[model samples]
Target: MTQGLSTPRLAALASAPPRPAPPPGEAVERCELCAEPVRDGHRHLLDLEEGEPLCACGACAVLFDGQAAGGRHYRLVPDRRRELAGFHLDGPLWAGLGVPVDLAFFSVSGTGEVTARYPSPAGALHAAVHAASWRRLAEVNPVLAELRPDVEALVVHRARGAAEHWILPIDDCFRLTALLREHWTGFTGGEAVWRHIDAFFTELKRPGRPPRR
Candidate 1:
């Protein structure tokens, strides 16, 4: 017959490696401040100088929300989503931007420069955007003129002879890029990506009256 194990031996056996914890839900997709490991609904901040996306938690995001901070490197990403229905762009001007696709997003870079980019098979591709043209576009839509440099973007979609514009957060632009990169198929991005894109735009709320030209 086997003897019973002592209390100390049982205690030692219980100290073996514990089971690994399961991954977090959608909210834990990436950290909003560091882009590390945050929940899907995690907050985010803007890197002003680098124009980079930062993953942050609620506390970290709150730290940079006040004017006394002098608006340093980090700024909390705002949740304002508005659609600019009256915004207009002619075909020639759109062609001049050189974006391969009809859909593109423009934002001020970390260096205090404006840039326009679009999703492609390879990744997000930058287009050559003349400042004068941007100014012209901004004339009709002054809300776009107020876009927080680097952290906000002006998204434009032109297809089937119609165009739509929206002022969105930079993180939203990244989300769109990530979606296209994952679901894109064929040269036109196929139906799956189109459906996803449609759903995203549908949620945007229209802005107030268009600003004077």
Candidate 2:
């Protein structure tokens, strides 16, 4: 007798369509210094003490745009992406740098120390840059003298019998490192990783400034 009124309700409940899940809320990226939401292409600052990058809103980025703006603790990462024309790095010279990998980035630290890093599956592998070799390389490439310490890097691409050189923001170099860490596979890095690498280089060349000879 009690089930009489519930029969239709039970059938209706069973026949009702399942409700859809609510769409995920997009995560908003915020400036590390001011806690303000930043746009997709916001500026970045380098933490000199920790050698890490921090996203910044427009106003915060302008504050540290100068060399002495943040009291030497933070440096604004520039958006320059330059392809170096007539850049020279001979085979013997590359070998002297002591980086086992063909792809690597070289940067000068705040204290005038130069370090060479190459992306590996284990992360970025560091190599000692012989002082003499670096000096010779910099001597030929005068543009290197303009490289702002801790913000820019001399990125070399020599993999797959290709020789390409670019002066990119430190953030770009780190992005390449992350890309390789995510896609690299096996001893030869597989075909997929190479495709990504090619695409990355293409993007860099597309809007890049006229080659600095």
Whole-model lDDT values for every prediction: 0.64, 0.76
Against the true structure, what is each candidate's TM-score?
0.71, 0.82
Best by lDDT: 2
Lowest lDDT 10-mer window, candidate 1? 1-10
After superposing candidate 1 on the true structure, give the runs of residues whose Cα lies further than 4 Å from its correct spot: 1-40, 48-51, 66-72, 160-162, 205-213
State the lDDT of candidate 1 residue by residue for 1-114, as single tens digits: 112212332233234343344465434345545455554345567666665556676666667665334266676776666677667677766776666678888887545567
Which lDDT tens digits does candidate 2 get at residues 1-213?
001111232233334454444345433468899998775567889888877778899999989889889877899999788889999899887887778888989999877778887756554466557778888888887988888898999999899987889998987876776666667787778888888788888877776332210
Error of 2 at 26 (Å): 9.2
RMSD per model, one decimal: 15.8, 16.2
- Clash counts for the predictions, in order: 17, 0
